[model samples]
Target: MNHTQQLVTTNPNLTHQNQVQTYNTLTFSEAWEFFFQGKISKDKLYSEVRAGKIPHLRLGTKILFRSATLETWFQQQELNSIR
Candidate 1:
């Protein structure tokens, strides 16, 4: 009946919650501010989202962009720009 035993004997949702905590999702505005900075303007960011070129998650009316995926996209963009 200790802490470890209590967690092991209890609800499984706690593990799932911990899994979810590891991922970082950002809003469109936050994603641009954090990742793009001076590289991409706000207008272009919204345009890409509207054009469906950006990877995103739609939850109800809100949009979320994954930090990892956005970083990958930025790397791709850099590669493309060199060519």
Candidate 2:
């Protein structure tokens, strides 16, 4: 089996593998860094997140986003732009 299959079959009780963990949410700085390779100004990143142009999750007053969701959003954007 490949690495991914092996990881899935591993015992769930073992934290070393087979355990998938996700961040509750990413801060603006954290999320921006993932998409952008270089330095990004805080003001611009915050503006984009606030404008609803970016995908995000809001829990009460807190803001968070799943990494996988962000990736899916990017893929959709690419497909839409191509058509």
Candidate 3:
């Protein structure tokens, strides 16, 4: 197997990051791994979602987040931190 294939096998999250744009929304796990790059814990993410502190949608038992929404949110976070 080549390097790309090796990476895919070793880190499934890389595959999700590559394919994130193709979807309109992302599952909870995919959103954190792709956007936060695992900088934050899953519990933090879940807490944000539960508290409505993050941009998200609820489909029955599943939670979904939009990449565009998160991109803007990150920018806002940066701006807030500068103040």
Candidate 4:
């Protein structure tokens, strides 16, 4: 799986050591690892994704996820369960 690069500033105070940190939005497997605390099987995760129950993105033919957004989705799911 390929990762999309994200540029983030590490330190704003240090001008001389200014550097941009590169991060990859989570892959399908990596993202699923956080889903339901990884209690579900990979096949089940894929099924959920296919059923549109989980949030994900398709870049061309590649499935990907934004960890922050996915986490928020999970939080909402938890809240819904409570209600």
Candidate 2 backbone collisions, by pair = none
Off by over 4 Å in 2: 1-24
The sequence of per-residue lDDT tens digits that candidate 4 reaches over residues 1-83 is 22322222233453221221123366776565544447888889889889998888989877887766776787899899999
RMSD of 4: 8.1
The sequence of per-residue lDDT tens digits that candidate 3 reaches over residues 46-67 is 9988999898999999999997
Better of 1 and 2 by TM-score: 1
What is the per-residue lDDT of model 1 for residues 1-83, given as tens digits with 9 covering 90 to 100?
55544653365665533432344787776677556654788899888887999888889877799867877887898899999
The CA lDDT at 14 in model 4 is: 33
Cα distance off (Å), candidate 3, residue 77: 0.8
Worst 10 residues of 2 by lDDT: 15-24
Best-fitting candidate, scored by TM-score: 3
Q: Candidate 1, which ten residues in sequence have the lowest lDDT sum?
A: 14-23
Q: Estimate each model's TM-score.
A: 0.62, 0.56, 0.73, 0.64
For candidate 1, report its TM-score.
0.62
- Which residue pairs in candidate 3 collide? none
Look at candidate 1 and tell me the lDDT of residue 30.
63
